[model samples]
Target: MKNKVLLLTWSALITVVLLASLSFARQGTGLIGNVFSDFNDFSWQLDEFYDIVGPTKLNSIDVEEAKKNITVSDDEIERHRYRYGTLADQLSNIHDQYAQRIADAKDAGNELLMNTLIEERDMKLADIRKNFESDAHVEAKIRKEKEKALVQYLNDVKANSFSLPVAYEFTDVETGETYSSGDVSVPAVYKKQFNAAKGYFKANSLPGHNGTNGWIRTSDYGNQAASEDIQITTSVKTFEGTVIVPKSAVAKGGVLYSQYKDFNKGRLATYVFWLLGIIALITLLTVMKFQKEWVTGTAIADWYADLKIDLKAAAFFMTALILVGYIDSKSSNLSNFFTYQSLGRWGEWLTSFLIGGVVMTTLFAFQLVNGVERWKREGVLAKDIKNSFTLQFFKALREMFLKRSIGVQSFILLIGFFLAGIGFIGGFIDGIFLMIYAFCVLFLGLPALYIFVRRSAYLNRIIVATEQMASGRLNEDIKIEGRSPLADHAKNLNNLREGVRISMTEQAKSERLKTELITNVSHDLRTPLTSIITYTDLLKDENITSEERAKYVDILDKKSQRLKTLIEDLFEVSKMASGNLELNKQRVDLTQLLQQALAEHANQISESGLDFRTTIPEEMLIAHVDGQRWWRVLDNLIVNAVKYSLPGTRVYVTLRKVGDSAEFVVKNITKFELSENVDELFERFKRADTSRHTDGSGLGLAIAQSIVDMHQGNMKIELDGDLFKVTVTVPTK
Candidate 1:
């Protein structure tokens, strides 16, 4: 229930965020408006100023005469500063100085001084004019002076201090003669009249000269030559108009309009309201579904957590979308309405939300289903849920799948259908159809394939079981369930299991019988041998009287000794079979040890009437073994060979180093049946002949095999009819 509530909350939050982003995208344009307003204000001010100043007019004679007579040097021009210094004052000083020079010249009658003074004054004037014409500061200064002069002229014109001239002399460039001709000459008269009109200008400065309409003064003389015509070419002052409009009004093409032509303003409010309604509807539906699922006990905590995470992701995406859309709407290059349209944009948001939600939910559901299936298949009991790790995991998984199943499936299907429709309409009908076909194949065919695969796997398991039964091993229990042919085969496997059990029981019984028979025989032989040894000891007393008694005593001693040897051999064989014998291992130099052993048996070898051939290396061949037991093994093999070997034939005792082990071999020509398998000669009481004619107790090889085993070595016998050979291999450390 808690999980369901959380999921609903997450869904609601994501929807709100996406809707808010779309709303913001539609309405935001403050930056665009501010930029346009600033530009329009600047342009409007410039236009108004241009209208007030009008155009400048220059007299042809004045311009032509000024161009021809004005000559200024580079140094003089550079030194001129019309903007910073007082022009009126400087001009007055020049005029006064020139006047004084003229007075002095006239008084003394010095023409040279006066001429020089006049030339200097002309140069100064030419310099000032050039500076004012080219320098921006000087141009600005001239404009300021013209504004002042224009105001004075306007005042003079208003006061009637200036008379309008009809005609004046216009100079001819070639002859320098005056002519009263056409309107060209009339412009010259207007120039003179404008100069004369300065009489009224000297009285007062006009208002509005620094502000808008101030250029009216310059415009009043329609045909008059402007003062400082080259300098005061244009007005610098600008006039501004107050704009009155609603705050909502947007500007377009330098004009503000009450309504936006691009966006459907009338429908915008309705659309926003409708979007809100839709969001609310979705929220309500989601909440109700959550409540329903919760009541039905299907809500999962993990699903709820995933839903919350997905909601946060959606929120982030919506925020980025809103920011980008807002920026796009404010940009000048792209259309605002096209950039901010909510229908297509919201559709995309919805699609993304559905896709993300479905994916998360589906993943969670799959994990849950898999876990639950594993637990159920393993036969985990419900009662052990608290104790079993598997049970708890399955429970958690089940809850996750059940709670989110419907919501996840619905979301996926909706998104899938929406994408399909979009693709179909986007000239991809074939792709849409293909997607549908693939989905069908995956959804329906996959389950069928799963069922078939499962059936095959079950059959394969049964076949494997049957094959195991066919082999010797049938101990495994076949616990397969069902009434199929494979199940019946499994039953047959169980029957095989019972049969194997019975056979193993019978084999165990036979092994026990064999062990009992050997134990009883050995014990019985020991008892009789004990009696004979006791009798032989009694008979060895000095009280025995004659040769017959001596003979009887000899027989008794021989029988006793033979019986003792037989009993000891039986005991040794039994101990070996039971694995009770032990070897005391030490590092023994095989060459030295073999020499010592051969020396101990040297007298016996000589007395046996057989030629004993001993070949061994002088170099030390070390082996890790029981020295005493290994010596005894060699002793038994050589003695047995000498006993059975044909008299007067050679007996060979050869020892050699083979890899990491030493091989000791004793071969002799013997008169024994060699038909028996040589390897089986190591078994207890295994003899070549049924009759006990040989002196050996038939346990020599068995004892040797046991001793070798204890030393972690190997012993074997090889027979070639009357030529028999025994070999013992002891490992070196």
Candidate 2:
């Protein structure tokens, strides 16, 4: 506890000292800049006094000297002659300038102003007509007008008092013209000590004159001219001047130089002291003990970090406002510290407010440092804002807008309620109005309430159906009633339920196939083994004849060959099922391959007592497939037909181009019933010879389908009672 207290104290001390240092640097001089700038406030006051007084003093002499050269030039007369253009243009300009004013005066019942404006327009028009073409007349008029304006300017300057606590003397360098005012004999030592004014001549002392002189045109024309209606030229006079600040003026204490000297004392020393104090405090705070305890994070930091982002931002804004107040007060005080100026009643209140603000800002600064350290260790502002309620609410709004129907409906409902609230506000006027509002609510609100309740119940139904589906009860589907959003949701739920049903059925079928697979494999292997074992026992009896031994041995050899064929076929089918079988695919003429398969089985087809009806295409139907695998496919289909077809029944083999595919179809009347599902015939070890009388391994169709599928083609079986058909379709291109 003691460490935390000391840490906070040291932190607050550092904040106060640092802020004070900044305030002084800003209001006085900067840390590494001119030390004399600490007295800039007094310097500014001195400069302001000189600026306001110097121009007034200089203008009097400048105007007096300029009035001597108030002569009009030929160019000035010509410009003034064409100032308003032709006679017609002059009349139009006059009308445009005063037409509205005259109308306004007449409307306001000011007949004097109306008549005066009319007279003035007439005078200007008459002047333009009389002097429009006479250059000499215009020049005479311009000179008279300039002299008249110069007299008026001199009179105005005389009326205004431009008193100063100094004396000035000027002498023209080229003409030796003297212009002096007040005491010109003041001591030269006092002039040098005070730096009262520049003694050298400035080229451009008059307004609007650079280093050259020109005719001073009036503002009526767009030339930059003299001010105050004083029409005169600068006349190119260079004057050397000296302003003398007397010791009497300096001793008076209210003059600018006196005020500056009085106020400038101890300003630099104050700044240096403040800078050293801040540096010392910074060093002390840096090496302070237990800094990690409170400078890292404290209870206040935890409280701030736990605040909502909006609240934290608001606190930071308030802290900023307080910091601004502190800086303003500190600067205001430091800038006037030596001036001894009082702000009257407001100053006390402001000082108290600023003290409180300073304390608050210092504490905020301490907490801000600690909070920043804590936030860096945890995460930045993005992490906090991500978990903020404002972001979450906006995220929800964004998701709602993804489905525009729901968003629009929700907005409409909100607007309806908001307008309804406004309508209810009128119910406060009278009790009868309240009763009317109640009736209106019942009339409109009932139907809306019914819709809300119905949708809620429908949503509940969908939820219940999803729950049942999750628990593996997919028999029931959601009942869709309307075309609303809720109804659409119910339809999707029903579709999902159907998909789950199909998946469950396929799973059961797979289980059944697995069981049948084991049974068939065991029976098939055991029968061959039994035959081999029985025949071997007969051969072992030496009493048997050679013909009997040879016959038993032949039986054994046939059984072993059957077992080997079964094992090999099983392994190949397994490889195909597990996707481990690789095919060597190439472009081959499928028509020739089909004919070759039939040629290979020609003897079997002839001996089976089956009538073979072949419809092989003479043209080549090319396809990309593994030739060896594709031949196996055709061989299996043909062999199956020959083995299973009833005696003397006709077998059909057809190969033709069908659309984008090359289709090979074989049809036969089966000796046994194909009552099983057509799709189940594609399962391994499943055959039409359920009694196990034939040597058929039941993998023929399965292997054919796997090979076709590997080539990105199709194999399908169609059964019509005892008539079975198998079709293989592969892409021709």
Candidate 3:
């Protein structure tokens, strides 16, 4: 905060200094312009260069009388006398010269010569003492002085005295032909008038009647030179320092230019400098505020957009500048004010600092209020510049271009044809303008329309593909062209189509399996139910033997038990598949659970005459799981192995901890040929043997897989020809 304040102070000071400099510049007061004056003073050889306008009025003077009018202090008079000979010494030299001439003339001359010398000496003495001279001599000296003034004035006019340019124009009174001064020429026909004016001038040198009309300008472009003189006058309001209003008796034709109006350039310059300083200070303040917005962590373009400073304010400034220029043109008084007036020197120095300080302080104060408002508004982005251009063109292109709208885009192209027609028709009337119009239509209009049309066509391809996809037509993928956004969209669309096709195929396969499951389930139920019904009907015969009745009863019990087991297995599998089974999860010893399951199946193992191979780990393999559901997985695997294993064949069972999981493996020789599609065993009502020879529902493996899934474990059935293997893994953590 302290640094920022300090920086603000410094900036204000700097701006003030710059503003003062600018004000001085506007006043035409500058250091470099005085370099020549300084050099002239320092140089040993004095410059005698002087500028004068032609036909200047020279002052008439009597030398002795002028000397008496002069006043000076004795000290200054002594200083001037030491540097140059005084009037006293000049008078003394003149007196001595006359006295010597009188003596010499009397000694060497005859009476006629001495008489002439005596009269000439007395006359010279009277002329010097009383300032008396012949009328012819006085007139001659005045004329000579006037000639010198006239020459100096003319030289001043040639070099544009006081750095003022005087533009000249001449109009022939008889022909009404106005000519640029650079384009006019003196013609032969004017020689008569020139001589007549000269004669008139010699007749009377007092100068009132000594004037003649003359051509003012010369030309070299053609032979259209002036053959006669013309009466001309300057129409502009100003001359260098004086204005010569023709009707005001200030200037006469070919006579003398007299001062009409005079204005001090230094006084006029003051108004100009003030106006410039005021304006510059305001502009500086505005610009400073615009820049300060960026210092408070906001991006520059964003702040510009937020404030509208650049877009609106800059345009206003340009318009104001142009307006001021036009206004200045209509008012010469205001123009003179800018051209001449200024504060001398000290005020210029002070104004610089004042301009800076005032501008900076004003801007700083504005930011204090406006900066808080910036927080409430979201800033603009770099992308907004592009968007701004797009919006600017939206009116022209809105009806057709953009948005992949092919119809609208093509319509614009159609309109372009008519625009082109108008352009061509316009061309014959005016080549330059119409040709420009034609190019605008052909290049700008046609190209813009075509660009949108091309984009629309690109977009249509995607639309067509999307429609086909909605209609369940996912055959061919859409093709892409170019490295534009549409190409990327096309690629994604193609991928979507492929994914939908695969999903449909998978759905169809699942439907077929569901249908097969219903048919197999019915068959399995009918087989067990038939046995129970038939056995119960046979047991109803009164004449049947006890042994026969007992055998039928045993068959009934066996089929009924098999049907119950199948129904239970189907229900469990369905529950797991539907995700409705609630689990009582707890830390259970997987090894102990495996041992208990083996003990429950020991009778079946012993009766089957199968050699049981067990590889149970001694350490507890603990995992958070439903103990009953996990045991069921083990039971199904053991039962599946026992039912499918060949009689008297070796049955192998292994259980161990594998990394973070508890794994169980069961292997046996298949009683029937096992198919290569072993994964089908996990499907409901599916088995290795198609015939219902085995006293087991095919739901065992499916139920085991479901229970394993419920426990978030992995179960797989592996088959190597007649060898069957099932592996189950459950996470221990």
Q: Write the per-residue lDDT of candidate 2 for residues 648-731, one digit (tens) a residue.
A: 989988898899999888999999887758878888888889898998988988899999999889988898888899888999
Which model scores highest in TM-score?
A: 2
Q: Which stretches of candidate 3 lie over 4 Å from their true place?
A: 1-471, 475-481, 485-489, 492-515
For lDDT, candidate 1 versus 2, the one ahead is: 2
Which parts of model 1 have CA positions greater than 4 angstroms off? 1-564
* RMSD in Å for all candidates: 38.0, 26.9, 31.5
lDDT of each: 0.55, 0.71, 0.58
TM-score of 1: 0.33
Candidate 3 structure quality by residue, lDDT tens digits, 657-702: 8898988899899888766976677788997667877777888888
What's the TM for model 2? 0.38
Q: Model 2: which residue pairs collide?
A: none
Residue 178 of model 1: what lDDT? 41
The alpha-carbon deviation from the true structure for residue 600 of candidate 3, after best TM-score superposition, in angstroms, is 0.3
Q: Which 10-residue span in candidate 1 carries the lowest summed lDDT?
A: 52-61
Model 1 has an lDDT value of 0.55
